[model samples]
Target: MKSIVAVQFIAAVFFATAAHAEDLEFVLVNDSSSDLVEFNVSPASSGNWEGDLLDSGYLAPNYEVGVLIADGLQTCVYDIRGVFDDGSSVEDYSLDLCDLGEYTFLD
Candidate 1:
């Protein structure tokens, strides 16, 4: 019957909700000589840079922070940029988020 089919579909949806895939996550480690004022991440194939992930905040020197790639992200390779305290910035492109679980800005 139609009602029976609807009930079965509802049940299947409820049961499948718990089988979601693990989200991509990464840690940004600061190894540079100065503190990080801003950190940004975007798809490597894109031409323009997006907004700052830090907004008005910062990542201190010798510290690190975790970033989660939100669900529905289409690309795996990402570009990252970190602005140092001395007004200098570093950019890394074509880094795969799934492959590199952790990234460090070298001195």
Candidate 2:
């Protein structure tokens, strides 16, 4: 009986961790007229951009992209940077990922 209880407790802990991790992910929407040529997610506490989350591809205009904060960081706040094809950029700082399910990049 003790073993069973221990297993269930571990399972619950695992699920909670998974849910917390999922909360750090959000969808990035491009609300501008130009394509999103660049994108990145950085920890708010780091003061340095981790790297481009969009990799080599471009997020087209009026499209939505999924983004996840840096791995293994116990942070809910982050900085988002989006660059458009028209040489314009938008930057947001200290945004809570759990509070923002969908972020719209506007002009």
Candidate 3:
């Protein structure tokens, strides 16, 4: 009986940790008139922008891709930036990615 209780406690702890470490995922869409050459995201509290998530790939106009934020940060607010092939860039501040299931960048 003691061994069974210990196993159950371990399982409960494992499940709780798994649930808390889940990754935040969302779809990124390009609705602009140009191709997106760069896509970057960073926590709202951090002033620095991380590397591009595209990894040498480009999102053409009217296209979309799935994005996963696995940084394990606690905050849901983030800053998103996209650079277009037309030499122009756009940015969004304080976006709640948890509630934003999908994001579309418009021209």
Candidate 3 lDDT over 2-105, as tens digits, reads: 11111100001111233365566777777889999988888788888778777666888877777877776666898999999999999999999889998889
Candidate 3 has a TM-score of 0.79
lDDT tens digits, residue span 1-107, model 2: 01111110000111223333543666677778898887877768776765555665677766775564536555678787888889999999999887888888887
Worst 10 residues of 2 by lDDT: 1-10
All candidates' lDDT scores?
A: 0.66, 0.65, 0.73
Order the numbered candidates by TM-score, best leading.
3, 2, 1
C-alpha lDDT of candidate 2 relative to the true structure: 0.65
Highest lDDT: give the candidate number.
Answer: 3
lDDT agreement of model 1 with the native = 0.66
Error (Å) of candidate 2 at residue 87 is: 0.7
Worst 10 residues of 3 by lDDT: 1-10
Q: How does residue 33 of candidate 1 score in lDDT? A: 80
The model with the greater lDDT, 1 or 3, is: 3
The RMSD of every model to the true structure, in order and in angstroms, is: 15.1, 12.7, 13.8
The sequence of per-residue lDDT tens digits that candidate 1 reaches over residues 1-107 is 01111110000111122234444577777778887887777778678776676666776667777776553454578788889888999999999788887888877
Count of clashing pairs, candidate 3: 0
